[model samples]
Target: MIEPELTRCVASFHPGATGVTGAAKLSGGASQETWTFDIVHPSGNVGAILRRAPPGYGAAPGRAAGLDAEATLMQLAHDAGLPSPKVMHVLTPEDGLGRGFIMARVEGETIARKILRDEEFAKARPMLARQLGRVIAGIHGLPQAKLPQLRSLTATKEIEDLAREYQSFNWPRPVFELALRWLRDHDPGPSSEVTLVHGDFRHGNLIIGPDGVRAVLDWELAHTGDPMEDIGWICVNSWRFGEIDKPVGGFGTREDLFAGYAEAGRKVDPDRVMFWEVMGTLRWGVMCCGMMQRFRLGPDHSMERAMIGRRASETEIDLLRLLAPRGK
Candidate 1:
């Protein structure tokens, strides 16, 4: 049966759309959901996606920039000619569709492994890193006046936050401690030019097409911070998907990425980027441990969570490679 509220809501925002069809939940968690559907129109079925908090889920969790902010960011990016999906409509209480917004579906592959290994993305792979650098530069260069209220972060603050979260887990890893110490010692302090940092600009958040990066998805982790943080996160080894040699998402070299950023008129701080890379590595490891905690505690008690906990060691190894390279 079609959800009556959804049908009515789409009809209101989608001009000439009679209703919505094939509304399917793409993925969701306790507080958020994503749905894919088609707007039934006289001309054709227009593909769309809905991201919402569902009723009763109020306020985004810590560090989230909120759904409203996400919509605004997407719209701004699209307006700025970035490879972003067009925001179709932001849901209101009158629509009975909870919070969040509908966006034009941009078809592409988000899986890093597929983008790296699949023959279809072979041509896209080689150009991805440099292209992504330019894309990220665009994101950082977005007008400050148009940006929504977001949390401001710095390297020192992020390090403290990560350290606190790791301590809460009560799981001790000597390698993690070493990395933390390294971060503290090497902290680059505040960035001279603070800009929008796509807090998670790595593999899973990107949509790649044969032409190159088609969209930079998932703005949940976005914040105001060092732009180099985005660059470092993209270079994290975990996102490399086994192509460890290629630092830029396992697709290209840092040189190319820097070149692209320079072409976009942004200065590249190599030292700051490296500092954030170490921080990003440890951050992923702590997040994995948190997943395991959530699994064991309650709610999402799944094997995937349990397995991800095991993968924290991968970050540990990566941390060693970064801090104390055996051959280098």
Candidate 2:
């Protein structure tokens, strides 16, 4: 059942509304509930999406206030001229939808599986790579002054703390444990240049259209930290979309991506990218375990969640192979 507060807020947002009808949930979201709605206002009809926190999920320890902050970050990113959803309205937990935001629904294909297989984007792969570099550069270039509300959210943690936090999750997966160790041993000297890091930046999170990447969705994991974090994340093997040979979201080689960056006047560092790729794998592996833990938290009906836990093995194996080749 749709809560009255959500209905009221939706109506209020669209003044002179005559009727509002909600559609089904959008696939691929696990942390929260998302639904599309149809509105019949005096002016015209428009479609909207409503996202809300699930019961008992946010109450868990170590789970930060995500949805509300994500909305703010997305808006800020959009305002900064980064290609993202135009912010509409943000509802607090006090507002009764638990926590959520409504934004302009832009059109593009977001499903990773489809984007990889779709023939239309195959021809524009090179252009996509260049475009991706530009957008990433812009996101990394956001000024700290404009994002004051994110101070507590962007607090940097020591590498030791990050390492300990993942280890404490008690992931039973062997590969995940090994990746954690690799990260600890390879810890780059604590970098304090806190820039905006898109916690998860890969092919799947981006939407492609005839024009270019229409929108960059899913800011739930956005943070303030190393710029290389996003760079490494985009090149992670798991995000290669079943095309292991070609890196950078399976669109082009690392060289191609570096060219795009160089064209944008951003210095290229192969070693930094390699380091972040390792970190990206370890971070994802740990997150997979966290999702598995949710089974014990509440309803764990999602086969996708179970599969994500299983995916830790692939990440671990990839990390190990990268750190230590079979025959040196």
For model 2, residues 78-158, the per-residue Cα lDDT tens digits are 988888887778875555666668776777787776677778777667677777877787777777766534422221243
Q: Could you say which candidate leads in TM-score?
A: 1
Q: Cα lDDT of model 1 overall?
A: 0.90
lDDT of 1 by residue, 1-328 (tens): 3357878988887788898888899899999999988889999999998999998889999999999999999999999999999999999999777889999998999887888999998998888778888998999999998899999999999999999999999877999999999999998888899998879888877878889988878899899989999999888999889999999999999999988888899989999989989999999999999999999997999999999999999999999999999983
lDDT of each: 0.90, 0.69
TM-score of each candidate?
0.98, 0.84
C-alpha lDDT of residue 230 in model 2: 78
Worst 10 residues of 1 by lDDT: 1-10
